[model samples]
Target chain A: GESVGLHLPTLSVQEGDNSIINCAYSNSASDYFIWYKQESGKGPQFIIDIRSNMDKRQGQRVTVLLNKTVKHLSLQIAATQPGDSAVYFCAENRDGATNKLIFGTGTLLAVQP
Target chain B: EAGVTQFPSHSVIEKGQTVTLRCDPISGHDNLYWYRRVMGKEIKFLLHFVKESKQDESGMPNNRFLAERTGGTYSTLKVQPAELEDSGVYFCASSQLTGSNTEAFFGQGTRLTVV
Candidate 1:
């Protein structure tokens, strides 16, 4: 079975510093990728997404970088804040799979003020 | 301007019991999906609905799980005679359309605990 995994299970960063979370996926056929933020006892919230054709996409304060050559994906957060403390997950969607998303084992981000 | 919403944020039932989780997607969104994550695992897809019809259900775990999207408004996932393995967090998501590039909005999720 194909799987998506994160390089780190936990990350701690100081406020105002940059944070990076990495993911590796097994399926080369996946064409769409997304990043989601999940707080405790809550559902995952959409952050940003990038297509396989592009290398990077930016949102309000988040950026998603995709390296197809290595099947690696990363979510970079600029000027991290306390509100940014949450679990981040990277999801991949296969080309033919319309609405199915395969999520990675999440990285827990802890922002220290 | 509401996002996806789910009902019964938490559920605890004994084995062999039945539980139903509900989801209300964003207004006028035509795509709906179901996903779940068991303890210490990643989130996995369950099924998808396009409008009022089931577009894909290959991710459904077994026949004991049933999903319905009547009127294409709200969707429900019913687990009958649930087993201990069914304990997990079930999430529902929706998108404006069904495409390879569309971003999906997720609900708060329903956490089920089977005793």
Candidate 2:
């Protein structure tokens, strides 16, 4: 099993503020990384992903940064909203035919209006 | 198109009982996966099925758990003699394509409580 961990278990941010969540992974063989947001009583929803070759990738309101040298991953949400409050997880996929994903302990983001 | 669908969003069973969970993947999806999250733990992979075949089941906890995908469209996971350690949220997911570049869609998950 892969070891992925979050720096913080919970984070509090003000609405309209930018929020950054960080993750550390020990698997050097992992080449693909993804960020998922899971609300209470719901399954994880994909937010953004980055390949090892890429350092950064952007989506509608989110940006995913991958640092292979440090083996760290981070998700940045611009202008956080109440709806953004959820548990965020970072998953790494090893480069192989199986493409199995190992998920890290999640960080709970709380948006305060 | 619909996402992955799981039956019986919640199940509570006595220890040493049998429980079976079902999952219906999206249309044309060839990859199906089962994951579980025990209380206060990370979500762990249980198995993966490619159509009607078991692609990888190394994560399955024990022989007491059985998973089958008969027609390649849907899958079922049966746990016999349920244990308290088996109480958790069971999630099912499907992907249209293989590889890490593709995205996997997840169902709401079935909460299993064993007492």
Q: Per model, how much of the real contact set is kept?
A: 0.68, 0.60
* Residue-wise C-alpha lDDT for candidate 2, range A3-101, written one tens digit per residue: 134343899999999999999999998989999999987889999999998999999999999999999999999999999999999999884576678
Looking at model 1, give its docking quality level: acceptable
Query: Which is the leading candidate under TM-score?
Result: 2
lDDT (0 to 1) per candidate: 0.90, 0.90
TM-score, cand. 2 vs. native: 0.95
Query: What TM-score does chain B get in every candidate?
Result: 0.97, 0.98
Clashing pairs in 1: none
Q: Per-residue lDDT tens digits of candidate 1, residues B45-99?
A: 9999989999989899999999999999999999998999998889999998776
* Candidate 1 residue-wise lDDT, A1-113, digit = tens: 11134344889999999999999998998999989999977889889888999999988888999999999999999999999999899999884458589899989899999
Model 1, position A111, has a per-residue lDDT of 99
Please tell me the TM-score of chain A for candidate 2. 0.91
DockQ of 1: 0.48
